[model samples]
Target: MLAPVTDETLMRRIEQFIHAEARLQDEHAYEAWEQLWTDDAIYWVPANGADIDPKSQMSIIYDNRSRIGIRVKQLLTGKRYTQEPKSNIRHFVTNIEVTGREGDDISVGCNVMVYESSLRGETIWAARTDYTLRDEAGAFRMARKKVALVNNDRPLYTLSFLI
Candidate 1:
């Protein structure tokens, strides 16, 4: 019989997975980042407020798996003006915690601060991100990713990179 994993082991695995995902984004490896998601993934960034319903309220981004693919394609095309130079970005993920778990799904929350520098200028963006990861046979894939920008209620610069 196989031994069951302990909570400490599982949390370590989850943290490592999350850190790898962040590195993929920082490297602008969109294709690899997409692979980190499950087939039925949902990526969302609420506009104006963190608690707003994406279906009823405006959203900075609300993409399903297909839409995420399209977005990746757009970024890879070398045609997006905002991404022409591809802002140099490196985000720090902090306060990572496993909030809940049900069956194969695990919920995680963290705070992120992304520092992006482009021709225009350098900008730092802060946000709280919630993620639901589906554990499939010991592998983890993102099922849902929701980002709530700290200054979402105010005017913001163009967000052309993954958060």
Candidate 2:
């Protein structure tokens, strides 16, 4: 049997994982990022607000595992018009909190600000991201991720880059 993990160790591990994930996105490592998710993953970005039901309300993105794979595949093709020039992006993940844990699954929340720069201009997008991560063979895999963009309630520009 393995030794139990302490809260301090677990928090550090979570922070490291989140930081690495952010780096993958910033570097546009789509394949590596896709491999970090579980088979039953849900990637959601709510449109109206944080509390709206995705099934009943509009969403910026609500992709299941297969759809996630497809999105990554498209990005990898170098044919995605929006990403043709490839925006310079950086993700800042902060205020990470362990919200809950059930069996092998842990729920975490954090505030993220993504800085994106393209030929057109620069934009900073802020959001509170809630994630459900599952421990798979001693490694963490994302099961669900919900991003509540601070400007979701108002008119916005294209979200061509990943948040």
Candidate 3:
């Protein structure tokens, strides 16, 4: 059996994971980002609270590994209408807190500020990302990723990449 991680270690790991994910997305390394999840992983962007079931409520995005791959492919292909001319984005993650842990799985919550620039210039958006991670083979793989936007109910522009 594996020993549990200390609170400090767990927090640090969560922060590192968030930063790595942001970097991968900023660099447009979709394949690398996809590798961060397990085979059965789910990425969810809940419209309301994290507790809400995506199946019941409309989600900003609720994708499995295969769906994620398709999204990545669309982004990279330059065929996605929303991605035409492309948008440069930088994500700032902060307030990382580990809320709970059970066995190899840890629950983390953090705030994200994403700045995206296109022909229309820059737009700033904020959201909260709740992550569930599992320690597998001594590395962390995402089990569930839930993004709760402050303006989830508001109309959204087309999303070409993973948030």
Candidate 4:
């Protein structure tokens, strides 16, 4: 059987990766954020339950590597009007836990509170984010990032910007 992780150094590294991701996204550094993901990574946001199959159900945003790149490009080019004026955003990533590990993949669970301000007004969004990070040589890369927004079931304002 596989043993649980008890390495402080390794844990710190993972925490840094997650924190950096939050910072990059908040700063609108799309190019840098794109590099944090693996070539086959997935970014998914389910519409209903967190356990719902994205393929079988409606999803808010479900993107493969190609789509992820395209989305970033659109944002950078200002082609996505929802982000035309851009929203001032800050991310609070907390309650991070190393939930599991198997082979070279590590599962992490985190709670995020994103505060956004735009001409529309101020909004606070909360979600449970689960990430599967794959050890890439000495670094960790995101293999899958699934975000279950607390208020996803209702009519949400334009979430054209990155979460």
Best by lDDT: 1
* TM-score of each candidate structure, all chains considered together: 0.95, 0.94, 0.89, 0.95
Considering summed lDDT, which 10 consecutive residues are worst modelled in model 4?
1-10
- Once fitted onto the true fold, the runs of candidate 2 whose alpha carbons sit more than 4 angstroms away are 1-6
Model 1 per-residue lDDT tens digits across residues 82-148: 8878999998999888887889999898899999998889999999999999998889999999999
lDDT, candidate 2, 1-163, per-residue tens:
3233467988898999999999999999999999999999999999989999999999999999999999899888888777779999999999998888899999999999999998778989999999999999989999999999999999877777678
TM-score of 4: 0.95
Which window of 10 residues has the lowest lDDT sum in candidate 1?
1-10
Which prediction has more favorable TM-score, 2 or 4? 4
Tens digit of per-residue lDDT, candidate 3, span 32-87: 99889988889988775656878888787899988877877777787876667778
RMSD of each: 4.1, 3.9, 3.5, 1.9
Alpha-carbon local distance difference test for all models: 0.91, 0.91, 0.82, 0.91
* Superposed Cα deviation of residue 60, candidate 2 (Å): 0.3
Q: By lDDT, is 3 or 4 better?
A: 4
Please list the residue runs of candidate 3 whose C-alpha ends up more than 4 Å from where it truly belongs after superposition. Answer: 1-7, 48-51
The whole-model C-alpha lDDT of candidate 3 against the native structure comes to: 0.82
What's the distance in Å from true for residue 131, model 1?
0.3
Off by over 4 Å in 4: 1-4
